[model samples]
Target chain A: MTELVKVKNLHKSFGTLDVLKGINLTVEAGETVVLLGSSGSGKSTLLRCINFMETPTEGRVYLNGEAVGDDVNGKMRYKEADLCKLRSRIGMVFQHFNLFPHMSVLQNVMEGQITVLGRRQEEAKDKSMAQLQRVGLAEKASEYPSRLSGGQKQRVAIARALAMDPEVMLFDEVTSALDPELVGEVLKTMRQLAEEGMTMICVTHELGFAYHVANRVLFLNQGEIHEEGQPQALLKTPKTQRMREFLDGHALFKLPE
Target chain B: MEWNFAPVLGSMDILLLGLLNTLKVTGLALLFGVPLGLGLALSRLSQMRILSMVAAFIIEFFRTTPPLVQLFWFFFAFPILFGVNMTPFTTAIVTFSIQSSAFFAEIFRSGIQSIDKGQWEGSKAIGMTRNQTLRRVILPQAVKRMIPAFMERSIELLKTTTLVSTIAYTDLMYQANDIAQRTFRPLEVYTVIAVIYFLLIFVFSQLSIVVERRLAKSGEGTVH
Candidate 1:
C-alpha cells in the first residue's frame, strides 16, 4: 500500500520553545492512525504542520508523493494559491466546530466546493445535501450553526469536510469540547468514514474509539513517539513506563480478557 | 419695541432651501465616504508597510483636526495650492467627505477587528483565499455591527455641514445667519434653526435604533 502521508524530520517551534522536535512518521492509504498524548505533547501541532497551518521550523511533509511547503530558491515556501489548493485536499476538523455561523449548514458545506473547486451551484448543492445526509443532518441544512447542538454542529463540520472528497481527513481532538452524551454521535460518523476506508489521522483522548477504530496507535510524549503498536497489543501491554503510566491515569478502558 | 415674527416667516422659503442643501451635502458625503472608508480601513490593516503607513497618516491627520479648520483649509488654501478653483458646494462636499471618512474608517476597523479570529481560520481551513474569506465571511458579519456607528457618523456629518457657512455656502445656517443680520433677530433666527436641526437628526437617530433592533431580532449579531 502506498503511503498517503509522509513526515520527514518534522520540527516546529514557536519563538524559543519547541513543539514538534525532529519527528518522523507516515500513514499508509486507508490507515486510521490514532495519536494519543497528554496535553502539550504536540499532537495537534504535528497535525497542523502536516497542512502547513503552522509552518514547520524544519522538515518536509509529503501527501500522496507531492511535497508540501517545498523549498523554492533556498526559501521554504509554497505559493499562496498553491497552498490553498493543497489544503483543500486535506480536510481538517477542529475541536470546536468552526462552521461559518453566518451561513446555514447547507451553505457552509457548499461554499468551499463552489469557491475552491469551482463546482456549479446545482452540483455543489446536490453534493452538499448528500454529505449532510451521510452525517444525518439533511433536515438541519436550512438552519444556522448557532441553532445546532454541539454534536450536531461537529457532525456538520465533518460533512463540510467530507463534501470536498478529501484524500485524507485530520481530526484534532474533535470530541474534546463535547459533553459526554454528545460525543457518541460524532464518533459514530467518524467510525463510518474509517470503515469505508478513508485515510484518517486523529488526535484524540477518546481511548475507546482509538482502541476500536485505529489500525495503529502512536502514543506521543514530550514531542516524540514514546510508544506505538497495534491498539489491542499496546493498550493491553504498554512497552514503556511512560505509556503505562499514561494509560494507568485513564483507568476507564476495560481490558478485554 | 414690539417684537415682530413676520421677517422670520417671510424668509421661511430660503431656510427651507438651505435645509435641502444640508440634506444634499450629508447624503452625498455618506455616499462617497462609506465605501472609501472601507477601503481606507483595509489599507490601514494591510501587510504592505508603505500603504498602511500612508493610510494611518491620513486617518490620523483628518481625525485630530477640527472639521471647521479642515473645511477652511480646503476652501481657502487648496485652490491656491492646486491652482484649480472649485465651487463652494463642491468644496464643502470634498471637505466633509475627507473629514467624515476618517471617522468612518476607524469605525469600520473596529467592527472588522471585533469578529472572532476563529472565523477567519475556519474560512481559511475550508480552502478560501484571504480575499474570498474576507468578502464572504468577515464583511457580512462586520457590516451588520457597523450600521449604528455609520448612522452616528452621519449625524455628525450633518451637523458639521453648518460650518460651511463660514465660506459663504448657502446651507440652513448660512440662510439663518443672513436673515439674522438683515432682521437683527439673532435669538429668534438661531432658535428656529436649532429646532429644525434637532427634528431632522431625531428622526435619523430613531431610524438607526429600529434598524439595530431588527438586526438583533434576525440573529445576525450573535456569534456561534
Candidate 2:
C-alpha cells in the first residue's frame, strides 16, 4: 500500500497548554484507520491539524507527500488561502453535521461545486442529485436541513463532502452527537463508504464500529500512541497492559461493572 | 355637517397622477435602500475595526436623528458644504435612502447574524470563497429573515415620500398641497390625500404578507 498521508513530529499548543505533542503517523491509500482515544486526548485536534483547521505550531503534515504545514524558524505556519485549498483536498466531517440551514439539501450540496469549482448549474445539479441518491436522500434533496433527522442530516453532510471529491475524509467523533439508535445508520453509511474504498481517518470511541470497519486501530494515551495493530489483534487478543486497561475501562460505560 | 364625497370623486384624475408619483418614489427608495442597506450591514459587520466602528457611529446618528432633519440638511445645508447642484427630487430620494438605510442595515445585520454558524462553517468546508459564501449562502438567508422588516420599511418610506414635498418636489403630497391651496379645501383635500396614502400602504402590506407566506412555504428563497 502506498502512503496517502504522512505526518512528522506534529505539535500544537493553545497559549501555553500543549494539546498535541509529537504525533507521528502515516496512512496508506484506501486505508481506513480508526483513532481510539478518550476525549481530550488530542485525537480530534490531530485530525483538525491534518486539514489545517487547527494550525500546528511545530510539525509537518503531508497530503500525497505534499507538506501542508511549512517549516520556518522551527515553527510551522500555513497561509489562509493555502489552508482553504488544502482543506478542500481533506474533507472534515463534524460530530454535529454542519449542514446549511438556509439552503435546500440539494443547494447545500451543489453550492460548493458551482461556487468553488465553478461548474455550470446543470452539471453541478446532476452530480449533486447523484450523490444524494447514493446516500438514499435524493427524494429529500429539495427539503431543508432543519427537517432532516440527525441521521439524514449526517448523511446529507457526508454527501456534501463527497461532492467535493476530496482525497482524504476525516471523521471527528461523528456518531458521538447522534442518538444511540441513530448512530448505527450513520455508521452503516460510513461502513458502506469504507467498503467502496474511500480513504478515511476516523476519531471515534465506538470500538465495535471500529472493529467492524477499520483496517487498523491506533490507540492513543496521554497524547501519544500507546498501541497500534490490526482490529482483530487489538480487540480480541491480549496486548499491552495499556490496551487492556483501556478496554477494561469500557465497563464503566456499562451499567454493571 | 353632511359629507361632501363628490369633490373626492371629481378629483380622482389628479389623485391617480399623485398615485403614479408615489409608486415612482417608493420604487426608487426600495431599489436604492436595500442594496445600500446591505452594504452598510456588511460594513458594520466587517472584521475591520475602524470602518465598522465608523459605520456604527453613522447608524447611531441616523437612527437617533429624524429623517426630516436629514432631508433638510441634504437639501439646504449640504449644497453649501459640497458646492454641487443636485435636483430636489434627486436630493429627496438620496436623503430618504440614507435615512431608511440605517434601519434597514440594522435589520439585515440581525437577520444575517440569526443564521446558524454551521452554515458558515459548512460553506467554508465546501471550498467556497468568502465572497461566494456571503453572496450565495449568507445573504440569501439574511434576506429571507429581512422581508417582513423590509415591507414595514417600504410602508414607512411610502409615507416618508410626503417629506419630498418640503423640497418642492412634485410627488403625491405636493400635488395634494397644490390642490388644497388652489381649491381652498384643506379639510377635503388633506382627507382625500390621507385616504389615497392609506390605500397604497394597505395594498402594499397585504402583498408583503402574501410574499412572506410563499417564501416560508417554499422553505428558502429570495426576500419577500
lDDT, each prediction: 0.90, 0.83
RMSD in order of candidates: 2.0, 3.8
DockQ of each: 0.72, 0.46
Native contacts present in each candidate (fraction): 0.56, 0.60
Q: Model 2 — TM-score against the truth?
A: 0.85
Cα lDDT over the full model 2:
0.83
Interface RMSD of 2: 1.6
Candidate 2 clashing pairs, residues 3+ apart or interchain: none
Candidate 1 stretches with Cα past 4 Å from truth are B1-3, B218-224
What is the per-residue lDDT of model 2 for residues B1-224, given as tens digits with 9 covering 90 to 100?
65565666677787678778777877887888888888888899989999899888888898999888988899888889999876887788788788888888888888888777866777777666667778988887777777877888888888888888888787888888888777667788889889878887899899988988887787754332
lDDT of 1 at B49: 93
